[model samples]
Target: MSPFDPFVHVIDHPLVQHKLTLMRQKTASTTSFRTLLNELAMLMAYEVTRDMPTQEIQIDTPLETMTGRVIDGKKLALVSILRAGTGILDGFLSVVPGARVGHIGLYRDPTTLQAVEYYFKMPKEMEVRDVVVVDPMLATGHSAIAAITRIKATRPKSIKFVCLLTCPEGVKALREAHPDVHIFTAAIDRQLNSHGYILPGLGDAGDRIFGTQ
Candidate 1:
């Protein structure tokens, strides 16, 4: 829970916090950074999907009959916000391999600091599936905002935005733009720097995850 916005969820589990600290270190290698991101995503997935509905069914065990509760993974959709999002996407897939995946390609315009969409695609029957948009950073919120706005047009059953790091400005902007969409993140740092980057934050998640830097 964030004071800035009630819709924002800060996942500060010990494991999440620990890995995040490692990822934030400038000395961390590309290989280690990428690994931590995926592992963090997987850990966060448990809490993100905590509210999912489950149904119990009777099953025959080795020695006796028992009832087991299960969730329908097919009812969920993972929409990655392009290249960086794919890192988080991989972890989520490991948790729910049956989930349908989608992609929305967006890049920030360096000068104006706005999001520019280059590509967009989603699974069929999005209106009936719960969508979780994955991205590593929510700095300006431009990319997440634009991606969610477009996804809303499809009228999905529900939508939740997941990111690794974010700042006050980014969270505020996103909450204002889409109050209905709940935001989940590992940590919320101090603020954004002049170039629209989260300060005291992990640098360019996309770059680090893919070794682009």
Candidate 2:
């Protein structure tokens, strides 16, 4: 029942750690925030993709009997969980240059606090791809769960969840709803506050990214 034990991986690469420090500080400028997110995203993508399959092909160059390599089947689909998730998309794409992209938008109902999907868009043949669902913050995990549920409808070959920061409660909720998901994160914070924000979180991710408040 330890929600933290299942499929959570904290990517602590030196590059990830370094960029995360800049991302957490008060002195980090808006432009700096963007740059850090992009850097961390690319670094995170490197670890997230380590288990991918590869294939070998025989090739002939100036010499003979040379073998080359390439990835196997089902190209990746990067599904952004909307708004804040968009910040990491470009960086991920920069690494997985051939990966497809998708978008899912969900809003929490005020009274129920349940996620309600307002929009979704995916690649034309998304069902055959390996999907990486991304969000910047995993606070309550309501939106992440709902977004994954929606994507599952497309019947992709695999699903992996990626977030910049994950809270314990959010990880629990996500694990319960989608046990097969492999979660990749930079750090796991503690619990959530009464307001549903992750304790010691970087504040509203959308607000911070957009300078809304």
Candidate 3:
């Protein structure tokens, strides 16, 4: 894809859009926000796993035996990128209950505005499984990029990125950094402000979800 073209999936289903509108409002309460985030995460997960492989097997019904299809190979890996990512983890897990959970804790360096990894843990035999990395915001793309970069070292069968909101700049940054990774987002805002926050976007997701700010 060209620099101007990023492989991004924007979930625009009516229900998703409606919940996203609620999420973008400043007056939305933490309880409501958390609930909406979870709902949206589950919806987005549906789109992300659309291409998952499935295999056919024989099954027995009360009346007769029949063929059935089930998810193929190893279970998917759900890796949350720290505090904010955890917000979406539960939602994602709701849909993929059998998915393996992992966490990569990264904090931004105030001075450099770069991501610094604090902790990283993942499921065993990562190379044999598909991975979906979750984070609520892709503002600067630094944390997502850093987290994905580290995850790539494990050589998974495939990898995809998921977020609640992102801007054009962030999409371009991440696409350029990891061209092979597909991105799925609920909405794409206009741009990031001077402070690295999406304009007309919901404020700090971690703080909002945890009622810390």
Q: Give candidate 3 regions above 4 Å deviation.
A: 1-6, 72-74
Candidate 1 TM-score to native? 0.97
Best by TM-score: 1
What are the TM-scores, per candidate, against the unseen true structure?
0.97, 0.91, 0.95
Cα lDDT listed for each candidate = 0.93, 0.85, 0.90
Who is ahead in lDDT, 2 or 3?
3
Shift in Å, residue 121, candidate 2: 0.7
By summed lDDT, the worst window of 10 consecutive residues in model 2 runs over: 1-10
Evaluated at residue 34, the lDDT of candidate 2 is 82
Model 1 worst lDDT window (10 residues) = 1-10
Q: What are the per-residue Cα lDDT tens digits for candidate 1 across 1-213? A: 257666889998999999999999999999999899889999999989999878999999999999999999999999999989999999999998989999999999999999999999999999889999999999989999999999999999999999999988999888889999999999888998999999989889889988896
Using lDDT, rank the candidates from best to worst: 1, 3, 2
What's the best-to-worst order under TM-score? Answer: 1, 3, 2
Cα-lDDT of candidate 2? 0.85
